[model samples]
Target: MTASYDAISPARQAISSARRVVVKIGSSALTSLERGIHSASLDSLADAVEARMRAGSDVVVVSSGAIGAGLAPLGLTRRPKDLATKQAAASVGQLALAHAWGTSFARYGRTVGQVLLSADDFARREHHRNAQRTLERLRSLGAVAVVNENDTVATEEIRFGDNDRLAALVAHLVGADALLLLSDVDGLYDGDPRKGDANLIPEVRSRADLEGVIAGTGGVLGTGGMASKLSAARLAADAGVPVLLAAASAADEALGSGRVGTAFAARPVRLSARKFWVRHAADARGSLRLDAGAVRAVARRSSLLAAGITSIHGRFYGGDVVSLVGPDDDVVARGVVEYDSTELTGMLGRSTHELPDDLRRPVVHADDLVVV
Candidate 1:
């Protein structure tokens, strides 16, 4: 039977009927404020996931706790500020975190495969395809792919910054039907829930629904906050994958009952896989500033031409992703550049007919472009 991807399923149906799901557990959900990994919580999450798998749904977990889990072991009182310290903590904690997950899942006779990824894993086309294949293979072998960012090696510039966003991207990579963001908070609220007057938002149909919501940062042990989760939801929604945000404690209900959490409906129109990857997965190496006419042409879905190029911002090679900027300094589109920055620098402002055959090609082909 063919699957539907045109519109988001209703909130209850989205979760209850998902054939494949990506569940992200935040640091606060996996670790304690005072010490190391919270064994009970991890075990409960494993049980919940096992229940989903038993019901015939493929599951992938994007868990964040390496750094937080490593804190007490390393004798640190708070999250490290420097990159090296963070990397060290990640290296120390990843083993413990993976072991805990493996042990927890084993109780239900389920196997788990650890898949650590760096930004380049998704940014580059070849790596992205390989990661997808790996995940598929793991699923086929009846093992849950427990994914996490390769924080040990990722620099700040290349980091996803939070696993919430990473989980959303993983959902797209695996063609998941829905994404569940399991964090400390039960759901998004109109104001700070701690203030006693905020009301829980049951659903977010669009960006406008989040107008007056105030999102704060994660607790002492984590990096992301409510805003990051919302952004992640929006990204997944754009790819036609609905998202649910709820407390980690509600994992069972969120996956089975679907009565708890804030559901973000998927966008009515889904981007093509290639365009989705270009827009959300690939990282921009540089930017190309376009003239007014060129901007108009791009808006009309035309291939970018050298004649429209006004300036280049950074060094980039052909096949690398770059941003297309308009006079207003807003990024209008993103795509794989057909020529290197050096080559385009010398060819800018010249009409296609005026340049050599090789240089006459569109600066960025329409097939490879995605309007932001």
Candidate 2:
């Protein structure tokens, strides 16, 4: 069925049956000023999470606000522009964010565990697998995993653009059944919520319907606007995880009332975690320009053959990440190179059947490739 805000019953049903869920709370929802945490919001969130736990669902919270919480006490009015300052704020704010969750959850006799992630952690296979295992262990131990980006050490290039994307990836990594994206806005609006004509977009079954509903840069907290949330929704949905976008204040009601927010329906079949990482998270170090036939083959989910490669650029070692560029020179996917740059050049355009037995294998296996 075509998903739309008006027809969110399917997504609602998913939420109702979801056993494991990942909730992403934006910085605006978690803190009021740079100096202190939002106690009311924190308490309300803990209550919602506790209720979910009571229902026997495993809950993980991916939160943002370390920098926001750290800002005011440091005497800053707005988010700092410099990377060092931002990192400093995050270091301080992270403690406060965790403390708030711990203190609030404690009242309900729940334990909270802190998980800090960086972009690299999700990119590499080993680290990603380890993270998933650790989170699973934490849940089994009856502790709520409260995750946030490792902002203190993150440079500009390594930083997650926003927590929304990080949360979406986390959902995939942990095999979450649903993702809840909490923000200041109640739900997605057709126009800017500040504008009277803006109407709430209740469901989004297709990306085409989201053409003009991009969020404005008007939210009270956090740099990510509606566009980022939409990206997050799309990410989660594509991974076979449904998503709910709603107001943080309404979190409890949304989780309990069974009738609020914008729900993005998920695809029926889910991609494997490794493939998701290859398709959505891995950074490419070089580009492999391919012939038209190679493009078609890759599009059909075939392994990239060395014979189809026409050109290569940038230096990459064996196992280094690279992009598969189509005939039109657009990146179609990413994969790890089986051969180094120099070796690939010698093997390029040589059909696998004609190559020596030692070189006959596919350059990149389908299992290791991710289409963009």
Candidate 3:
């Protein structure tokens, strides 16, 4: 039986109807000093993308190869350990990588736009909106966007671990219907593929099924591992975006001739963009101490009632972000506060019936809440 988009394996079916698609190419797939730009892979990928564009699809490429490609030219033997050296290599390599992509796509008369991003840019609300607008405009102009991490400036604390998560976030930001993660391996296996009796999963229905599955360590030249790819799949699935984990060398087979790898299914209902960011992107500024009653309400998917609020922590003004902590002190959700910290302190633990008429409403409404 063929799997439906919401069933066991749906990525193939999802791609057929996907209006906007995001393809993430790992570092291993795009670079090589001895073999430069992987000609067979590039040609296959370009051909698939060109065909998709001609069929009225919007395709965006999230690639990771700047530092990897630049390593040979800089006389470095391996990936750098220090941030400064890594940044220098990325800065030099980004130019060469962009040139190669431009030349490769030129054959199809396609224009490519380079967009380098840092995690901080997407953390703030205003900047996130602006980034979204810019990418949308580029797509509307019929140009392909080649996105990469701004490794030239990223510090350890500020850097996204790998492009996998970035690709998932990009898929959500651009409202992509599907995401394809192309790497050296074909897809997720039941165990290490080299082990005896190991099997191809072919489909993933839930996280529960992934238990005991030994994911492969990533290639030495690349930053992402199988675990990180699975993490990205979880994010995309939650956002209602199907994902495909396939081989870069098999781009044509995966995209056109037939399914060539594992596919992650999309969730049925997607979170709103703002709430999605609040749940997945925004780092909480502070936490609100909730009483037992508040915990129960939140567990039931209810809003934070003013009477159930016990105390507030940290300095935050009205409309600032805060986490909702249960009586156990674990954060259950994040939301924008309607009042400042000082105002909340005065109203905390007060019954709505006993409060002044103006303070009878919720401290944090359900609309503003994002369950983490």
Which numbered prediction scores highest in lDDT against the true structure?
1
Q: Quote the lDDT for 334 in model 2.
A: 87
lDDT of 2 by residue, 256-352 (tens): 6446788888988998876787777777778899999999898888999998999999988888779999877789978878888988888989988
Q: Candidate 2: where is the Cα deviation over 4 Å?
A: 1-8, 217-220
Query: Candidate 3 residues 62-130, lDDT tens each?
Result: 988888877877877788888998998898888878887888899988788999988887788888898
Predicted structure 3: lDDT? 0.81
Clashes of each: 0, 6, 0
lDDT string, candidate 1, 110-219, tens digits: 78899999888998889999999999999999887999999999999999989999999999999999999998988888988777878888888888999988888767
Please list all clashing residue pairs in model 1, or write none if there are none. none
| lDDT of model 1, residue 203 | 80
Q: Which 10 consecutive residues of model 1 have the lowest summed lDDT?
A: 1-10
Error of 2 at 308 (Å): 1.7
Better of 1 and 3 by TM-score: 1
